[model samples]
Target: MADVVRPSDRFRQGMATRRRVLGDAHVDRASGSATPFDQPFQEMITEGAWGTVWSRPGISPRERSMITIALLAALGHDEEVAMHVRATVNTGASREDITEALMHVAVYAGVPAANRAFKIAKHVFDRIDAGETGGGSHD
Candidate 1:
């Protein structure tokens, strides 16, 4: 039999923050798809990344969004970069902000990484423009 774990206070906060940033639809899909093997991993990120880091007050969500995109690009995490790019609609990071972050990534992380990230960002931007992503573009 499987054991049910009660959510911690931090986990609940993280879930709220995650939903705010990623949207209810995305969160629902992810939660619905979680299997036993990956459930623990999901919980960990919810509590650690969203609850702890993202919930902190030092930086705004917009700044965190830019930093997340840049770091994902630098690490060549293509899917994550695209996901975060789409997330900008909620984070309030404008297209210009993402572009500037990528520019920095080019100089600091490497041109190749930045170039790939740009392509991914552009695709996400196109979707945003088409009104397929729900949230309006920040421009």
Candidate 2:
């Protein structure tokens, strides 16, 4: 069997990344709604996705953001894609990287998914540019 990974470190690192990428307001909203049913799941994501995977030393956050954006777009996860899109600003992914990722999604994930992802990304970018609070900060 594979080694069982403890999540303490992952949780801490993931929380930092989550806070940096998603901002305190978004994190607060997520934590605020944490119920008995979802708390465990939330922790799992924090430790596993944010902490372990995202905290790995292999790639820079910018590279990870690009890959994440492409994957989310391809998977038709528009909301997640949008969130990550906003995260690109902090990761230094630039608008060009996102455009290329969406283009790849259009080719591989289907135009519909790419279209929706683009729309959501645009909206998020607009909100960010407008300096809306609660949308999270990159740094």
Specify the highest-lDDT model's number. Answer: 1
Task: Give the alpha-carbon lDDT of every model.
Answer: 0.89, 0.80
Cα lDDT tens digits, model 1, 80-105, are 89888998889999999999999999
lDDT per residue (tens digit) for residues 34-113 in model 2: 89888898898888888878888988888899889889888877667877887777788988888888898899879998
Quote the lDDT for 133 in model 2: 46
Query: How do the predictions measure up, each by TM-score?
Result: 0.92, 0.85
Cα-based lDDT at residue 128, candidate 1: 79
Candidate 1 deviant stretches above 4 angstroms: 1-4, 134-139
Model 2 pairs whose backbones collide: none
